[model samples]
Structures are given as C-alpha cells and as structure tokens.
Target: MDDGRENLDREQTIDRLEEFQKASVRAIEAHGFELKGERNGVAVFTDKETAKRSRDTFRFIAWDKVSEVADDLIRGATQHEEYTGVVNSSKRTAEYYVRVHRSLGMIQLRVLERQDWEANERTCGHDFTPNPPISSISALKPSGEKRTVGFHVNSRQEKTCIELSLASPTAEFLTNPWSFVSDHPLDGGPRDYSLKVIFDQSMDEAKVAESSLELASRTIFELDIRNGISLIFAPRERVRVSFDAPREVPRIRFPRVKVPREVAALFSFASETLDNPPYVFLSYYQVLEHFLPMAHRRDALKVLRRELRDPFFDENKDVTLIKLMNSIERTKQVSEEDQLKVLLRDFVRVDKITEFFKSADMKHFSNKGPISGVPEVVMHLKSDPLPTQAAKRIYALRNRIVHAKDDPKYDSIPVLLPRSTEANSLKPDVALARLLATEVLINSQD
Candidate 1:
C-alpha cells in the first residue's frame, strides 16, 4: 500500500513538470520570442521578426528552463524570510529580463589591445567615419529589445575599410567565409573591399554568393576602365595597369567611331559576315553595292542623246550616229549600273578614292598604311596609270568570285596579305570592297 502511494506521488510530480513546461512555452510566445530549436540539451528561442530583418540568428534561452529554475527557487523559499524575499525578486527578474546575442553570419569585432601606456595614448577608439552618420535609435520595447543595424567607413592605417556593425543585445561584425583578398594600397588610401553577398531572405546562400561576386566583377571592370587602369586576370596572378592620367588613354576620349545613321544598320551585317562562312563573299559585295551611287541605264542613254544633239556633234553627225546606235544597244542590255567599274568610271574620282583609302586604313589598321600589298594604293589611285588599272583589276576579281562557278581566280587573290597568301588566300577583292564600304559609311556620317 505504501509502494502504491509513492508511485502516485511520482506520477503527480511528472504531471506538474509537464504542466510547467507548457505554461513556460506559452508565456515565451506571449512575450514575442519563438522556440527555434534545441541546442546542447537546452531549448533555444529567438525573435522571429529580428531574425527575418538581419538574416542573422538572435538566440536566447528557452522559457521552459527559466520556469524550472523559478520553480526550484520558490520551493526553497519556505526555509527563511530572507529566502522568501530573494525568491520574489528572482521571480520578477526572470519574468522580465532577456538577453540576446548573434549566433551566426556575423561576429563581434575585438577591441585592439595596447602594449604600453604610450601605445594606449596613440590609439583611438574605432577610427571610422559614418557617412551620413548612424542614428542612435533604440528599438527596445517593454517586452523585448530590438537593435538597429549600422554601416561605417574607416580610413585607418592608410586603408579604407567598410565595417558593418550589427546591433543585437550584444553587437557583432558580419562576415562571409567566401571573401577574396587583393593587393592593398601602399599609401593607405581606399582599398577595394568587396561584399560577396547581401543578406536576402528570398535567395539561397549559394545564389546570393554568386550574384554578389558577379556584380563585384562587373563594377570592378567599369571602375578600372574609368580610372584609366587595365585589370588583367591570369592564372594565379592579377595584373593591374594604371595610367598616370585619364588623358593617357585615348580610347576614353572617343568611345566609338562615328558612322552614318542611314548605313549604320549595314555595318552590323558586314561585321557579322566576318564570322559567317557562306555569306562572307556576299557581305562584301552587298556593302560595295550600297556604297556606290546608283544610276539607271535610261539615264545614261538620255545623257548620250543630249551630247549627240550639241552643235559640235552635228558637224560630226556620222560619227555621232554610229556612237549613239552602239550606246543604245548597250543600254538595252543593262537596267542598272551598280557595278564597281561602271560606278568608278562615272562617279568616283582619284582624290575621292584616296580619301576613301585613308579613312578605311585609319579605321581598319588603326594606322595610316597601305591596305593589302598594293603600294600606295591610295596614292597610285590618285596618280596617273595605276588608278584606273587598279580599280578595274579589283572589280574584275570581284566579278570572278561572285559570278563565276568553281573559278581558280577566286583562289588566286590574297585578301589579308602576309596573313594570307596565294596557296592559302583570303579574297583580296572582298577586303577592298569592305574597305571602300567602310569609307562610304564614314563619309555619309558627316
């Protein structure tokens, strides 16, 4: 009967402990703290709203343990009047006091220690400048405390470092394990400090890291160029080429070579042909066709007729009649005169050809040199004998490549010169056509 009574008391004690645990959990929930998980046999709780905001875990002791401790103190309070007073004070403290600290994603920065009294005098506390100074605002409420985040820039030891101070019950520094280290400025100027990721609740950790690195790389590239520095990345080494002044880099002054708006659309197509195999030849011819001034066969015939009607031609009527008949027959065979030879013969002059060569050379080679192996191709075109011959030969080459099927002449001409030869040739005709086309496009812009 006594054993049965002892078992009954044990069962009652277990039931009361369970009741106390449940009540403690409820009280914690009412106090705006959530039971996160158990750690080291201790029930862990955190502020759910703070966790969401900072992306850092703010941990506290679970209320179940708090209640158990409270129960033990109250049970012992019946021993003495002083004990009773202590129990009441402890109850009040347990009910109100809560402490929180950063568990992960950030850490507390350690204060630098001084070796001697002189070192202490020289050292200052947190040598940092908060741009748009951080407000000393507290989020502490009657139930719980909330801390506001802060950012600052420090220029200590000639280096600019960005520091993030996280405010919890205990302050801590936020850090990432996947950060990269680069060369520091020798003079202690602003050093590159990269944040590989920003705390975002929506993205997973890996994605956040990847996005942050990509953004950092892009920003670095832009900064390097803007500051007249060339950053070259190689295996195991990073090369940075810094210029003394922005003027040293001419490319910045002129970002792009101006081209005519009318023919600007064609330049992309022409550029794309350099990559495409089948359309390569066609691209050159198309550009050339567009570059030339278009003329109708009927227009040529009308001009011929007007010349023949002149008084000087009337004296030579028989010669004029024969010439007119031949011209009429030729005009009947052709509807348009877009052919390079015909266009050059009718419209393009020697000076104009030289100008085209100079413009094309300036753009393509980035230097004023002879295009292809043609010596003074520009000057020769401007001078006496070779001008017309060179033009006709270039046109003839174009015709063989475009019109002829399986022709050897197409393989004979070297387009890229020393880079290409008779045995392994790039079509010279295509090269010349592209060059002239580029010139036309440039001229049309002005």
Candidate 2:
C-alpha cells in the first residue's frame, strides 16, 4: 500500500510540473513573444521591438561582460534611425541623431534624408526615409528624459571620400563602417543606419544636446576656409592627383591635416621655458622631427624675434640675446610694456587673456587700460605695426584655448595657412607641428 501511494504522488508531481511549463509558454505567447529553441533547455525570442528597445533605450545593463561593440553589429542588431525632415520639401538633408545603450556611452550619428526620390514618393528605393526633427527635445517630460534623433549625410562625397575610406576621426563610429560615404546606398539599393533613442531615467547624470539659441553662444566663430577656396576656384580644374603617385604633375592637395597630440603642454612652458626644453620634454622622446627642432634655445628665439618683428624678416638680430631674454621671461611671471613680454605671459598662463594680464604691469601703461575684466580686449597700436597686431592676436588666442573660453572673433582653419610646396614641405603630422610652431613663434616675439 505504501509503494502504490508513493507512485501516485510521483505522478501527481510530474503532472503539476508539466502544467507549470505550459502556463509559462502561454504567458509568453500572450505577451506577443514566443519561446523557441527550448529543446536544450535554452529559449530565444524574436521580438523586433524588444531587441530594438534594448538598443534604443539606455538602462543599467551588465556592460562589463560586453564593453565595446562595433557600429555595424549595433546597427544590424538594432535598426535605429536618426532623422530630420522638412514637411512638404523635396530636397533631402542630414539629421543629427544619438544612439544610447545602457552598456555603452551615447553613439551620435547624423541621419540624412533619402535623395533622388520623387516628391510624392514615400520611400527612397529601399533606403531609410528620414523624417523631421532629428532629436526629441519634448520627449523628456514624463520620464524625466528626452530622446532626440539626428541624421548625417555624405554631402561632400568626393572630397571626403579618401578620408572616409581611411576611417578618419569619429568616422569609424559612423554608418557604412568599412565603406566610404560615396559608396552609400550600398549596392545602389536601400542602406540601413542606426541611431539610438534614450530613456533618460536610468542616467545618474546627463546633459542633453540643446538645439536652442543659447547653445549658439558656445560656438566658435570660423570662416569656412575650405568652402571659400572651393567657391573661389569654382569650375576651375587646378589638377587631379593620386594618393600613391609621386609629385610628377601639378595638383591641388587637401590641406589641414589633424594629427592628435598633447596641446596643453605646448603653451604651459612657453611662459618661461625655451621651446627646446619644452619640445624635447613634450615630445617625450617620441618622433618630433615635424615639430620644433631640438636646436639651441638661443638660435630658436633669435629666429622667433625676427619673425614677430617681421614674419618675413632676415637680419642677424642677435639670436643669442633673444634666447637669453626668452629664458628670463619664462623663469619669472613678470610683465613689461614690451609687446613680446605681454605676449609670453598672456599666452602661457592657461587662462583668459584678460585674466592673465589683470595684475600685470601692462595693466598700468598700455592704452587698453588693464583689461578691466570685460567681455573683450582691445589693444590700441601706438607704433611699430608690422605683425604686432597679428602677434597680439595670437597671444590672446592661446589664452582663450587654455582657459576653455571661446573667442567670438577667432577662426579655426583646417590649415592655419595655405600649404606652400616651395616654402615648407610638410608631411601630414608635420603640418600640425608647423601650426603649433606658428602660435609659439608669434607669442615668443610678442
């Protein structure tokens, strides 16, 4: 009787377990999800929305296990799109969009409109159709967060072609990872891109990108040198050149090569140290053939003084004397009526130009009257104006950069100056060094 009862109890337990499994399946199905791949006790669900939501929404996920992911995989796994569209407009444009993952920081991309489509067409072949307003500024109210989306386009297709092919800065993080922007509409068919939508609740601290006018105040003023030059030479064929080809034919090459380096160290020692010690020190035994040479400090200073007085000057104006003066200026934080002294102090302080000169001796004598803690600085020229104005401007700019303050009148050029094959043949990295040198040379003389 005991054995029979035990068998009955075991059968009842098995039945209950089966019932519970069925109920679990039923519950998942009711939620529009299916339990597949359960034969090995493993289940996989194919919910497009759920997977997409996981990508778009930022939450506390175990990122330590999956720290980094390539943009392509992210796009494929989550088909998020950034877009900005104008209603009733046929012309297409790019939109700025952000992709936020709980595991990864925000990935920002620009979503562009579908070009070559009919005005009445809803889609561009098979490409993603970008709609208006890339970001959702108003979406933040209820959950205390907003989700904005934006799109980017290869507007400068050919010019940016090689750079894109080379995977330039932040370009590797963009759509069509391996392919250039010109190769878009992949295979001449619809191309897919990803953008993220964030649910801000999970963020402990977050600052959203503002699209308002106040945001404009933070921007630096720069004339589009590339665009200007292009306009000036419109319909003119300067020359076509190949990257691998030698300089056999006259050709117009792209300028303003950006090679990343430590900028903070460059201006710091220029206050009192010679470029020799600083360059060697800053270079840290790295390749600096393109930057300042490790020549005698005295010789470098002589060349600098002559150039500041006359950027094109060519007189043996005591290179040794100049070097000695530079060392003294750097060693002490003293300021004098001499423009060169003011320039060194202002350029090296790593503060606002006005703040740097606030307590300096120039505050008492110069026509500008001690900076006054105003929004801007105006230096009146009494005499000797070859490149002095230019020199003063360079000093002020260095100060602005050091302090993280934006100068409304300053300009950011791809290349600080036009490339001249005759004057200075600079490699890509060398060009960056030259630009830094220009800043140092000008400030040293001032």
Candidate 3:
C-alpha cells in the first residue's frame, strides 16, 4: 500500500503496471478483441485496421511518470505525432489499447473510456452502424441557421471525419466573413485540426461547436489508439508562448513603489495558465479582491464628502442628520460587487479599457452580452465609462466562477462545467482578466 509515490520508480511499480496490462488484455479478449502486440508504448488490440496504414499511424511520446496514465497525456500532448491510447468495452467497434503509466490511485478504469455514457450503457464511441445512434448532442438544439450535422457510419469503420481534419484548411479567413473553417496546429506542437463552426460575431454561443469538435476528435483518436494522436486544443502561441514572462520594459524601468506580497503572488498566478482559463481567471480575481476593503472605504468617504458639502446642510434637522448617518452605516455591509465597481473606477482607466475593447475581437466587451453563457455577464451598452462595462461583466463572471456546486458553505454560485464549449471560448476572457490584474497591481503600488 505504498501509494505515497516514494515507490514511483521502484522496479515493483513497473512489474505491477505490466501485470495490469496483462489482465486488461485477458478481460478484453472475451469479446473477440485480441492483443496483437505492443508498439511505440501502446498495447495494440484488434481495431478496424492494424496499427498503421504505413507510417501514417498517429504517434506519441510515452509519459515519463508511467503512473500518471494515458489520460494525463491528453492535456499537454498537442504535438503532430503525439496521441493517447484508450480502452473500450464494446465488442462491435474498437477494443483495448493500453498507454499504461503506473501511477497511484488514478489508474483504475471501471467503465473504461471517458466518453459520455447514456443509461450507463458503455456503447461503442465510433460510428459502427449505417446511421449511428442519435447522440446527446441533439439535445443542444443549435440555431436553425442551415447547419446540417451529418452522422456517417460505414462497415469499414474508417476515420472519415478525422483523416480529413487537415485535408483542406484556410490559410486565413477573409475579413468579417460570416463563417470559415480553419485548422490550427498546437503551437510548436501537432495539428489540432480544429473545425470550428461559428455564428455571427455578436452571438458565438458554444454548445454546437464543442459537441462537433469533441465527436470528430474522439473518433479519430479512438480509431488510432496504437498511433497515439492527442487532442490538446490550446496552442502554445496562445495559452503559453513561453514558460518565461516578458520583462524588457520592467528591467529598464524599476518600480518607484512596491506591490504587497499577496497581490504580487496572485498577479504571478494569473499570468500563467494552470491548465485552463477559469483557474487563471480565479487568480486574477484574487488580486482584485486584495484591494476591495480599501477601495470600498474610499468610495464610502467620497459619498460622505459630497453630501456634507451641500449648501443646504442643517445641523439642527434630525431627519437630514439621520439620513447622512445611515449612509455611513450602510458602508459596513456593502457587497463585494459594489466594492468591485469602486475598485475599477478608482484604479482602472476609462481610456485604456475603451482602447482595449476597440479591437475587432475586443468588441465583444464594447457591447452588452455574455461570452461564456453560464453566468450571463452583460456589459453596459450606455454612455457610462468603460469601467462600468468592465465592472459589470467582470464581477458577474467572477461570482459565477467562484460559486462552486460542491461544499454546502461555498455553494453560492452554480458550477461552470469545464468541458462546455463555453469554457473553451474563454481565451478572450482570460486576456481581459490578465489586463485588469496587471493594471490594478501597478496602480496599487506603494
């Protein structure tokens, strides 16, 4: 029971992983799936085709820490040749493939594949029948805007949607085109072959796009488990250009003032992607919260000053005096939402925010609308300053993200599902959070 990982690289770990692979092969063989052999670290079983149709077989690097398992490689494996192995329970379609990394408790696969199951039915993920079974994707009820989704199933079990992923793609789209398909390779990695269907610029809701992408990629990867093709979406050029953050300007111009330790740490946390946008956004929100108390106090004092300076002020009047006293008392119970609005106005620049949102992509925030669709963050489309729009949108998204479904005490917000296409569209939101966090940290220096 040495699961503490002190035994990670011990010879016993390798022996256990080998035993597990042997047992999986035996169990899977019951349904006509046979372990042909092991090649490139993937235990090949009877799929539609043999391991390769020549060298065209998808390839991948074996994860060093074997125990982290094949699924863990699905995260960072965006390279051209890189793929993760999968095991399936169905006898009709594909079968067992092991990209075994003998780690800790994470290795068990009671149901096998990660694909969504219906009525706990572990059906084959591939299109084995002439008309593949209707998917939960239909429940999404996408726009009636002439998008006909095709469900193809051939007796040969070919990778139709997959093999064609990079067949023909746009070099770059025309300016303001209604829709176009583009294949973006993971930055310095392999081709992601992302076939994104889009709507008009104003309403890019995600359910349709996500469902399609997941189905297509999953199909290709499953068909070629021995080849090891991975589906990590974020490009290195996007999520993380480099592990190092740029400091050319900062090196030449030292800060006259210093940021508090907590604020600085949060700023650093927000700068890097901890796997996804939500995690990074949470870190940025933390930096913003560090100043809430001080900003809230400053806002309260401003109200008191404006009220006291009125020419009609009367010290003898009890009604007027009590009203002013009540204003002071209300500050003690002011919501963090109100304080966030104050923080934006007090520290963030209107001109800067307006400039940032003026870009074609940034235009999302210039008008009132929700990007992710979960929290329904609507920016202000009024004559008020840009910070008003920023405050409204940022606060709603922040609150929605912070509110977790689990843990009764922290159950103030609904859970933002990680796999939703809405979550995938968060790159723009991530950019916004990064910009806001940087501004607040620099402004709050002492």
Candidate 4:
C-alpha cells in the first residue's frame, strides 16, 4: 500500500509540472510573444510586432536549464519589475535581452548581440562592411584588425542603439578586452559588445532621459580604461621627484609611502609631464630638484666661514677670501653634489646608508673590487662610515655627463660617463637617484 501511494504522488508532481509549462506558454503568448514551438526540450519565442515589421524575428529560447527565466518573467509581470535573460551561442558569446514594464500600458525591450570569430563573416550577411567603412580610419587600417563602436538614436521610431563590429584577417580581436572576458568564461562574456538598448514609445520622457544619461556615463567610464589607460611600468619603479610649490603643495595619499602628500604631488607632476610629449630627461630632472634644498648665498657663506675658521682652512686672509668667493660660486652652480649632500646630511653613516640601500634593493654599489670600473671616490665609500663619499662620486659622474667631457677623472681614475645616446646604460645611476630621493622624502617629514 505504501509503494502504490509513492507512485501516485510522483505522477501528481509530473502532471503539475506539465500544467505549469502549458500555463507559462499561454501567458507568454498573451503578452504578444509568439510561441514558435519547442525543439529538444527548448521552447523558442519571438516578439509578434518585431517579427511582423522586420521579418527578422528576435529569437529567445527557454529550456529546463534556464527554467528560472520563465519563473522570473512571471514574477516580473506580477510584481512590476524588470526581467532579463540570455541565450548563449558558445562559451564566449551570447545574445542577451531584457524586458521591463515601464507602466500599466507600456513595456521596454533591449537586446545585445555578441558574435565570436567563428561567426564573424557569416553573422552580418553581405560582405559585412561597417557603415562609413573602416578603411577611413588610418590607425585601424594598419592595425590589421578593426573595431568600431557607434551610438545612434532614432527619434521617429523611439529607439536608442549601440553597434560594435570587430574584424581582423586573423583572430586579434579576441585579445585585449576579449581576453579579459575569456579569463572568466563562466561569467558569460564582455557586456559591451554590440549592445543595443531600446525603450518603448509609451515610456515617460523623463524616465527615458534619465536612463540614457546613466547608459552614457557607464559607457564612457568603461571605454576610458579600455582605450586610454595603460600601465607600462610596475608601481615600484621609483623616480626622483620635486615640486614647484615649496611647502604648500597639496598632498595626496599613495601606498607604502609614509609622506604620501609630497610623493603624490611628485607622481602627479611626473604623470602630467610624461603625458605631454617625450620630455623624460627634463621630467626626471625636475623630480630630482624637489629633494634638493634651495641654496641661499647668506646661509652658504655662514657655513663656509665656519669651516674656514676651523683648523681645516689656512689662516691667511687671501686664502680665506678666495675660499669664501669660491663657496658663493659653487652655491650658484646648482651642482648635483650640493643636492646629494642636503639629502644625505641626516643619514650619512655607513650603517645607515647600507641599511637604506639594502631596504631599497639597490644593486649599484655591490661590485667592490678594483675591476668593477667604479671611481675611487665611490670605492672609498665601501670602507668609510660616511655617505659623503658616495654623494661626491655621484656628483662627479653627473658633472661629466652634463658638461659632455670626453674623459673625466674621479679621484684620478679615468671614468666614463653615460652619453645622451646611451640612455639604456644609465639604469644604475637612475636607480640610485630614485633610492636617494625616496630616502630624502621620507626623512623630510621627521
């Protein structure tokens, strides 16, 4: 008796499922969607008016795999909310559509059609050339691939449209933006391809306007990252930086930097400078200038006078006067050594310099033997406890390069400075400068 009762309950559940399917079909048809019969358990539907007007039926399919679509549509009709569904062609492509009930009397329809490389030539029909032609865009012509995104509005018919076409002799279209989509294959595909949004004629004008504005804003934001921004270098690739504003520059926060405001300003300036043209040298020099203390004649003279009065200088008046004048001249020169001294004054000990260099992961000073080709002044810093020796060597190298000296000597060793043409060879010095600047900026706040 228990076995017979279980069979009866199973039969009743199957009967109820079939009845629900039939009712869903009736409700779909009543809402002006034509039931185009079922194939392999998938039921297809087309809008009656769209089929009549274009003879191009907008096809949507419902199956047991997506039974939630039917349930959601039914719930939307009852609760007055939007319903959306997608029918995928492949793992990476699909056709998506949305139905929104705008009011008691009107409904909105939207469709997005996506095509992959396999269907590229066959999907559009008749040679599939973009309107106005892709040949007219010079940049795209040489790229061997073409992508076009166009927006149109038909006021007479009350429709807003977006069209995207990507074509290539090979399969480069599936690279950039498409690669990002392909990474997460289970999430459908890129949402922007060949999107077409439309609202019914009966929709309120104000509501329509608001929706249009929202769509425009979203499209612009996505395109800005897709086409405009490119991260060419890693975040840790540091550069020496200085600001035009002395102390009142607006600070911005950046990751890892303790004094973010100054660093942020420096990065902003560097970005702006790089965006203009190819003024890399000037831009880097400007950054280096910011860490340097401004040289005032009176302050420099006081320091020089103090030094001369010490046992370090001769007591002769002529020698003293000559030294004072020379100090003034050096201050006017804006030498890189002066900048380095100012930056390293507080942290000149060998241990401190070594610790900072290790933390920054600097490799410029690792080669210590005679065969390393480093100048004597730089080599002496290896055994010395003061950073002054390293600063002097850097300044000497800077002078030789800036003045274009054929053969400059540092502590009597023949040194070769990097020429303008040998920009790639200057990586070591550039890295050192960046590290030094970073140290200076961090200490400035304290």
Candidate topping TM-score? 3
Residues 1-446, model 1: lDDT tens digits: 12111122323333544676756655555554555444333344445457445332433333344575334334331111110111112211100011112241122111101001123322334443322212222212243333323233323442222232221111010111111111111122221122211222344433432343344345336434653322221111111211134345655465366655545666456556453322454565565566454434435657686777767676356887776777767655652233455544444445756654554443332223323333233344344433354455455444434454455764554443111122023334345555556554544443
- CA lDDT scores, all candidates in order: 0.37, 0.27, 0.45, 0.40
Question: Per-residue lDDT of 1-446 in model 4, one digit per residue for the tens?
Answer: 12111122323333545666666656656656655543333344445666346342423333352344444344332210111112111111111122122251111111111112232333332334453323334233455444433323323343333223331211111111211211322232222223233344455544543454344345445433654411111111123323234357667766555554655566455456432221333333445455565323334666777876877576567777787777778777755565566556553345656654555433445444211334433333446534565565455455444454345444444333222122323444444544555556666554
**CA lDDT, candidate 2, residue 152:** 23
lDDT of 1 at 368: 34
Error of 2 at 141 (Å): 36
TM-score of each: 0.28, 0.22, 0.46, 0.30
Winner on lDDT between 3 and 4 is: 3
lDDT of 2 by residue, 359-437 (tens): 3344332335322211222344456332333334333422322333245444331112111121111121122223334
Please give the distance, in angstroms, between residue 259's alpha carbon in candidate 1 and its true position after superposition: 12
Give per-residue CA lDDT, model 3, range 1-446, as digits (tens).
22122212323333545665544445444433343343334333332243553321211112232223232222221112111112111111111112222341122111122233233111224432222112322333354222222222322232122221211111111001111011112112222122222112232233323333445456546634733333333221223312235545454666665788777787787656555677777788888888888888788999898778977767789977987899899988888877888898888876666656764265454334335422222334566566766776778777666666667764554566453344545666766666777777777764
Model 1 Cα displacement at 156 (Å)? 80
Candidate 4 accuracy as lDDT: 0.40
Q: What is the lDDT of residue 335 in candidate 2?
A: 28
The count of backbone overlaps in candidate 1 is 3
Residues forming the 10-long window of minimal summed lDDT in candidate 2? 160-169
Off by over 4 Å in 2: 1-331, 335-384, 405-446
How close is each model in CA RMSD to the real structure? 28.3, 24.3, 19.0, 21.6
Sort the candidates on TM-score, descending order.
Answer: 3, 4, 1, 2
RMSD of model 3 against the true structure: 19.0
